[model samples]
Target: MSTAAPLPAHRLFSPARVGAIARNTLTELTRQKVFYLLLLFGLLLIGSSVLLVRFSFQDQFQMLKDISLGAMSIFGSLLAILATAAMLPRDIEERTLYTILAKPVPRVEYVLGKFLGIAGMLACALFLMGLLFLLILFVRERGVEAEMAASLSGDAAALAAQIETLRAQVFHPNLLAAGLTIFAKTCVLAALTLFVSTFATSQIFTVFIVTTAYFIGHFQATAREYWQAMGGAAWSKAFAGFVAILFPDLQIFNLVDEIAVGVAVPLALLGKTLVLGGFYVLIYLLAAQLVFAQKEL
Candidate 1:
């Protein structure tokens, strides 16, 4: 029988190696046809926004804007939780994890690579969906502008100013910033999902736990405040506080409403979101590596 050659004395955590795994993971996920949700998202936005605009009688662009951003947040959350949660569990279940780990690859690299892949896939989905959303808003803005230009029989300057204001409100940069906040939220959630996948009993368990975590995190602030406001006993207050401290504060990313209405999201807030999200992701990845290292095949 032929003997296998030993691994070369090289860094196991090279970007090239990690990137190869990441690319493969991304390709695997794309083949699963998750990107097709873009079509469903587009259809929902188009169909609902049109009906909403017809019934509301005004502010068509804002209606579309609100709905599109809200949908993006929902889609991003679904992707972050489901994609990362399923990756490691599926590989382990199919014995693919053994095949990879039996080679020269380190467990840490596997964790990081899988995370990068999920994050890359998520970024692509968010961008495309956001683009389609913007395109819809663009068309709506043009139609609204044209209608106003034609309908107004008085001051041309005033009409032009109104259209300009409409343009600003419709194509606001704050919306894009809001999308970044959404992406940041996705990153932290994805990392948490990855951490869970390393130790959960099954893929289904991982998904369920992380999904529940996200919902809890989303309402963490409100729950904490309610419990603190004399509606509960000391133990309940302690439990609520513990839950709030356990999950990343997702309320910080609740910028969709503010951005949808043209309110500026402070630069400082965006910066803090990125920093905190990144910190949580790093912590989760490190924890995953430690747990995975001790995990039996």
Candidate 2:
């Protein structure tokens, strides 16, 4: 029997090779079945919206917006961190890393492909979850209009304006923007987690550190201000500056919270967030490649 010819040695870094690794990585993550959490959240969303109706209708809708968007942010971050953090160590434990690296693949391609796969999976999860959120919010919007529209007894013009406000608030473009922001944040977390996994001996260690970093990122601005306030000594100031430069400024992405409440974000700011995230992803992947390449398999 004849065997197929091998790919040219120089093409090892090509997209085709990189994409193959990514495809396998995606399949591996999918088999882990963590994505079932998305369905569970969808059910929670419906139940929560229904229960929220017994409380203030106006407040309930806003709460719905918060819960839905916030859930996506929380879930996406957890998936990105846990999934990417575990991947490298697990591959090593299973001896799969040696098998892949023993082939024609470059270390950079392997690192980059793994990140792409994790990111693609994150994007898919966010999009599906976001769509489900929009559907639930639409249903809540219609129910609110049906029950509250007539009950909104006021000056005719004022009542009409209030109704329009509710409608506009529920179906705003801000929801999609919030979804995109969550996905971008997930990419950043995945890259950072992958970088940590390169040297981490255990998955628990990687997860704990990444989770802590994520929490700190939320208050990066406040921490910076406080550090500046503590300018009594040069050593203290230098230490604070070093930390600030090392960790990402994650507070900047918290605009999703405001956007969920119907506050509009400028397109320029959103574009900047995506670009910043892209840079982090690029830098982390390169660093991961460098570290993993030198690691004893």
Candidate 3:
């Protein structure tokens, strides 16, 4: 029998090779109807913010902010989990992974490709919802400002001038903080889903595990405290410590309330949290690569 040709190791890990995988995964994701369904649901939730604003008699701006921020978080989290889980299993079930693996592409490149593709979709969802949020906030703020101006007893001209000034102050950096915080929070959640997708064998299991992890990751500190209160119980403490190391500290990225209340924490603190999130993403992706490498097609 003729000798099989040795695969070119350098070409297998090249950036171009990885990018092609990412592109293919992205195309596959876009073609799936589940993505469009979620997008429609997300848009519907975002559109409902106008109705939410109408119900708030006191500080309608706060109401709008709450709904908009919440919609982004919920939809983004779902999209991240859904996309990451489905992509891997779809390839495997179709027997397409075998063909791809037979090429010069490494399994690690495949994982990274899937991760980045899902991430790109999440980023798009965030941007779309983020724009919707800004528009709703703008419209609500304008309506409130106009009402206040019309209620003014003095000249209309002076009232209009005052309203313009108020609008400027309303959309200032402090007010914009909520939007920024929500985006950061989405990144953390998306990274988490990506990490979990690496090990999960089935799409349903991946979604379930990632969703549970998302909820518990934020409360791990509370678990630690509970363990401490148990009087140094070995099993409890061990479980808490295991959780602490396994999950990313999600509370660091949760600044929605602080932003809503206009509290100014140091920007440096946010920067540090973002850096930690990045570290988690890298570590989890690396772990996923290691796992995927050993997994048989």
Candidate 4:
């Protein structure tokens, strides 16, 4: 009896397979109760910022952007960690991982597919939150303009100039850059969590480890600066350097404060931050694949 011809090598690494996996993952994630709860909380927090009436218009606008951006960052990070930390362990627990791996799907493709799904979810969440934020800002801007126009009715030229200034402040182009950077930061966290989950025994352990890494990442730059400035022993400096390499410099993605206070984020700086985030994602995904390939299903 003649056996059927074996499939070509290129078919083993097909994008179609990866895309299918990604769509499946995304559907699974969206069905979770935690996803809806977190998204609702984030939207509420952003909307509540508009109720602060004690501050002047300028201060209110600043606070509005600050609070909204901060909420987006926090919620996005939490979602990334929680969602990704559970994926691998959950799949393995349900024996779904075994079935997937039994196919010709490569380990690398599986990892890439999972991360892409999480990334897509994050993008959608950010878009919704950003839309609400922009809406609130627009409403507030119109209200302030009307109030000022009524008070300065005698001076038509001055009213037009003031309205123009308010529009400029409310609609700065850098705000978009700030939103993009926040998304990038969340993607990095998702990738890191995926790497940790590859070897983690349980979902709780993965969450704990990734949460610690998140805190450490925020303080990484500070620790590196202090160690280098103190002129420590070789081992001390070497240890600091090791940490610097292992944990991402999350501060580099912190443009919320600057953007909050109306400081313009340069296009070049935004590009650099995005590039750094992409680098971390690539490195962690590669590392996860290496570990996952040898893992016993």
Candidate 5:
């Protein structure tokens, strides 16, 4: 009897197979009601941006920016939590993974597909909300400028100067940077959730673990503070370094304060954040594929 040697490991990462898996995964997600709910929630959060302006006492531009950014963060996080948890296990529970696994589809392909599917959903959510936020901010900024011009009886030059300053604040580059940072952060969270779901027995477990990670990821700055306060003790420093390696350094993507106040972020830093997030996402998916390949469905 001749024995067939196992296929090589490098074949698992083939782009063609990964692309096919991604397409199928995307199609499946589009057919679900959960996708619609997520879309609706995103829209609702965006629409509330306008309403939040009324409470700002005509500081509507800043208010609009705040609400819009906040909405993106909240909605993105929730979508990541819910969508990833339901994707894989639902298929496994229905024994659908068996059908897919029986074919030429590799475990790595399946995991990559799952991650990209959720990433696609996150991308859509971000674009939709980000566009709406931009439009609302533009309108609010213009309206506020008009109001300021009408109320001020100063010289034309002074009035123009005031409007320009306000414009600088409202249409700040940092605000745009902040929004993009949040979008990037959401992608990282989505990838993390998908990675966790690859091995989790239940959606609850995925949710619990991802949420904990999210909290810890957000606490990167706090963790640094603790390490500094500990006087650089070896164990404390080691623990902090371990955390830095294990969890996504989410603080890199937090530009909320800068956005709200219009602080400039270096282009280098922005590029670094994207690269860091992409690296983590790739590592996570690879790790997930390793575990999932041995899982008995």
Candidate 6:
């Protein structure tokens, strides 16, 4: 009996394989004690913001939101960088990468799997932090309501109006949007770190390069504007353009300040920021695949 022909190379791509790799990556990352420690520290930092009750109610809420969101963003970014920067190198050092690639898995799928794992972990961490933030806001609002009621006991009408206003401010829907923006920013950072890790000689080198890129990305917009408005030389302008294309303009993802200050984030603006973040993620993942495909085992 004649055997059937093997499938084509393009048909070899399998979501099941990608999913398996992603699950394994996620398990490995979750088992690291450093991740738990970092997460606990972040939660404690957020909870500590409740101590800023000396300010007026509005100011107190503002500070609370500001501090909580800032903690999330900073911690989330650090986790993204640390988790992604170490993944590839650790796998290689342990020979897991060789065994995995020795299978039928394509390099592209492998890269995508690794990124998905990181993204999943980030999503879980953000969700936990966000839930705590919302809970804190709810509790603080209740405490403030009690204070307002006690102080304005003689004026029930004014008390109701003030409580309603406080409720609106404390639980603004924009908070959800802000949380999403922070998550998107972290995802971009994770993808960028992964891209750097592909060719980096070691985890330290990958982390260093990604950290530099993070700073450059945050300042790239301002630097570009300064260069263009200064009417600099051709080379300066060329350098600015090159930097702009090379690093993502991370400022666009900074809706935390606006949300903290109670500036309404339009749905359109949130959509644009998320899309831009996703674009950067896709670009970096593609670059990583290209570089990784040529990398020898």
| Per-model lDDT | 0.85, 0.85, 0.70, 0.88, 0.76, 0.88
Worst 10 residues of 6 by lDDT: 33-42
Which segments of model 2 are wrong by more than 4 Å? 1-9, 148-164
Report RMSD (Å) for each prediction in the order shown: 3.1, 3.0, 4.4, 2.7, 5.5, 2.9
For residue 170, give model 1's deviation from the true position in Å. 0.6
Question: Which is better, 4 or 5, measured by TM-score?
Answer: 4
lDDT of 2 by residue, 1-297 (tens): 999998655864689878988998999999998799898879889889878877887788889889988889889998999999889988998899889989878888889889989988998888889889888888877877776657766567877787798887668877777887888888999999999999888899999999988987777678778878876578877776777788887777767779977888789988998888899888888888889889888
The TM-score of predicted model 6 comes to 0.91
Which scores greater on lDDT, model 2 or model 3?
2
TM-score sort, best first: 1, 4, 6, 2, 3, 5
Q: How many angstroms is residue 181 displaced in model 6 relative to the true structure, after the best TM-score fit?
A: 1.2
Error of 1 at 296 (Å): 1.2
Q: 2 or 4: which has the higher lDDT?
A: 4
Model 5 C-alpha lDDT per residue in residues 1-297, reported as the tens digit of each score: 999998766563678777777777777777765456446744665566646755653465666666667767878788878877888888888888888888778787788877877777777777767776677667767777787778886678888998888776767667667767777787788778877887788999999999999888889779878888878879888888888778887877777765675567888988888788788778877778787888878
Runs of candidate 3 with Cα error greater than 4 angstroms are 1-12, 33-58, 156-165, 174-195, 229-232
> How does candidate 3 fare on TM-score?
0.83
Looking at model 2, the pairs that clash are none
Clashes of each: 0, 0, 0, 0, 0, 0
TM-score, each model?
Answer: 0.92, 0.90, 0.83, 0.92, 0.80, 0.91
Q: Write the per-residue lDDT of candidate 1 for residues 52-103, one digit (tens) a residue.
A: 7665324677778888988999888898888887788779877888888888
Look at candidate 5 and tell me the lDDT of residue 221.
72
Worst 10-residue lDDT window, candidate 4: 41-50
Model 1 residue 17 CA deviation (Å) reads: 1.1
Pairs of residues at least 3 apart in sequence or in different chains that clash in candidate 1: none
Task: Report the Cα lDDT for candidate 1.
Answer: 0.85
With candidate 4 superimposed using the best TM-score fit, by how many Å does residue 276's alpha carbon deviate from the native? 1.3
Per-residue alpha-carbon lDDT of candidate 4 for residues 191-271, written as tens digits (9 for 90 to 100)? 999999999988999999999999899998888889889998999999988988878888888888899778988888889
